[model samples]
Target: MSELRFEDVTVRYGTGRRAMKAVDGVSLTVPTGQVVGLVGESGSGKSTLARAAVGLAPIAAGRVLLDGRDVRHRPARGSGRAVQMVFQDPYACLDPRMSVGDSVAEAIPRTGTAARRAEVTRLFGLVGLDAAHISSRPSELSGGQCQRVALARALAARPQIVVADEITSALDVSVQGTVLNLVRDLQQQTRLGMLFISHNLAVVRYVSDIIAVMYLGRIVECGPAHEVLTDPQHPYTRELLAAAPHRDGYAANSAHEESGAVLDTEPPDPHHLPAGCRFHPRCPVGPLALPARTDCLSLDPAVGAVGRRHATACHFAAPLPTPSHQAT
Candidate 1:
């Protein structure tokens, strides 16, 4: 069963005509004992959806289901401890004044002094932090260490699902792999479900069993990580994979970053998203379509399955025999 699910969820910012939907009609599930990776560029609403699950973001429409219950009815004030989040900034989320031991101990249900201490010590070892560092403050620990502490605190509650929003984005490349390995091993041991969000495709592809691609608040493609990365159907997915680092593929994203997007226009205003396929305006081939690109410009495309465990939302989406220009 899906431990966490979003059913046509939409998160809006502002009110009246000024309101804009940051996450629109997003339906996803994080089942038990699996990692679902979400990949998108900045302004793509990846974080918004992640926040909605934990009652941090208001759901403008639709429902967020946590452990088979609607979050709105659950009243996150009490019965909402089933899900925990590890944010992008490891240091910011932590309390500077509180000692790391106390921070983790706070999550333990046991009120006895000795019980809390023992649990904290065990948690420290689980996250690879030393028992000696229990009294350390946030300022005393390194970035990676602080992150491990944050993770320890999250796990102390034994939440069923963990929402990790770019948790490693701020760490050094050397530390990033270590953190990833630690998380993967922990997930296996605990059978914890995860919603991993990041702009880094390499990390996502490695850790995620399934991957979903987002653009401008809409999911454009989703499937098994390896299939989606190596044989993309949607144009945007192809671009994202082509730019993925360490893959034996051409660096198309680098060119896009240096010069400009494939489409030679200003970034679309999120406040006033264009009608039709949200990705069409930026799609290189959509403009040249027959029928005056009416469907491409006016009708939103529904996600259609093209192969096993794969789907794409594009009027022109067609899987290539080999989408990536990788060295054979």
Candidate 2:
């Protein structure tokens, strides 16, 4: 099985004093046949990290490896590329003038015209689109259909790894579940290593095998999906879970009350990141709930293992008491 690994990857934009580390010292792996959900707030660099995997973002340091081989120097687009990305805006990715069939066909490796057309039909069906709509243009499809077409295009390349960046966030609430279910189904059937990026905790929980919680440009916590959601160790992870809409008592059962107030403030400027722990200023368990720890303000905490394969990057990382309202 193939594996996509981000080894201490750092993505920096601009140069000199203006440079911003959009993804900082992050290491994570997505082994084929499993989904690793990357979740965080809007500016938490989740998208940047996804872009880096497909070579859309420049890496200032570290490497993105596919099966232990560097992917930075490899082709990031076309059929030759092993990594494919499904962007958030599906319509934007498709050409308005091209027939949806032709759009998907563009990613397939060269073959006989009849064979290519057949492959396009098969891909459409794989993504749950009607083969009859193959000739339809992007303007003729609904938002959900367009997103599925985008997914079809990505899969047409026969990629080893797929990076889905908020692929369902653009669709209607009713449509979101359909697209998500299709994704989960496709992943299971194809066993493609997938990095699913979203800010929605509930959505991540629905499709992910493992979950990585990012904050600022760093991953603050990560573990099996169940463990991270049920017993978050980092302050940011707890706050993120609490902020999610209640689902199966998961959100409501988070250690929010003990973790402290909701995160109301915006994160610090990326260009002028705070010293020490980057989340110190807004961390509920730190300055917000108790006296600010000097370590939190002046020293960056290294990620430490809290459980089997579960890790958190906080000096005070510990399991909070189970919430009283937790579902049995």
Candidate 3:
């Protein structure tokens, strides 16, 4: 088991004035045997952070560490790579011409031919795929099956950390649950440190022990799964929970009604981000609230503790009012 730590990690694209910061000074930890869910809307830099872990995205500052060693410039090689990623689109990741078993076999460290075949068979079972599909191509399998092959390929690498970037977003609604369950079961069995990225709060909550909310390339809130879900502190987080689909008996209608005005507009341009709080333009409790907090325009709030194992990056961080609170 190994832990993956991001120490003030920053990722940027392009150069000079045109450079856009995709992931800003973010510090997150994915301890062994636990899942850290990274949740945010599209373009919030959730995927960029995932890519950085596996050397797909370039890091401009800070370090990505595995077991206390910096892997920023030179990622671990072979089995030592430790971190493997499962991308959002399974079809895109797997080669169209290759057999599914061969695709998975490519990721395995060099071994005897018989051993490699046995390993592929074992991985197929591990991901709940039938051994019969070993010779199937990506086009021959359904969306859910393709994702299973993707998971199996990642497992073939024998990684200690798995970064799953919206793995289920591409599947049908009914199939998503099955894949999520497989992931949770696999994590328990292997105890692999995982960074699961998604835009859906409900999905993240179902699979994660810890959850971190991102906005405009910065982690705006982070805490234990239950605490963050039932009592979101940051306005952006609250808005996200409010907008989450009311399924699985979870509903944040009160928060939705209170903060619906915030998300009506799009987030500010990342290339030319606003000064101070990047979320100020769409923050309900900042620029849009009654009396309008002026400090949000000039002072960037750093992430700070709001509860045990809970932190939010907002000067006005507070629990979103519930129906009971409103009555009082």
Rate residue 173 of model 2 by lDDT.
98
> CA lDDT of 80 in candidate 3?
33
Clash pairs detected, candidate 2: none
Model 3 agreement with the true structure over 1-328: per-residue lDDT tens digits: 8999999999999888998999999999998889999999999999999998998898899889998977554534555357889999999999999999999999998789999999999999999999999999999999999999999999898888999999999999999999999999999999999999999998998999999999989998998888788777777887788778757655543543453366678889889999878888887666766446887888877634343235678876664334455555
Point out the worst 10-residue segment of candidate 2 by lDDT. 302-311
**Could you give candidate 1's per-residue lDDT for residues 12-117 as a string of tens digits?**
9998899999999888888778999999888999999999988899998889887779865644442326788999998898899999898888876546788779
Per-model TM values vs. the true structure: 0.87, 0.92, 0.91
Off by over 4 Å in 2: 75-79, 252-256, 303-309, 319-328
Cα RMSD, each candidate: 5.7, 4.8, 4.9
The residue pairs in collision within model 3 are none
Show where candidate 1 strays beyond 4 Å: 73-80, 248-266, 288-294, 303-309, 318-328
Question: How many clashes in each structure?
Answer: 0, 0, 0
- Which wins on lDDT, candidate 1 or candidate 3? 3
Report the C-alpha displacement of residue 90, candidate 2, in angstroms: 0.5
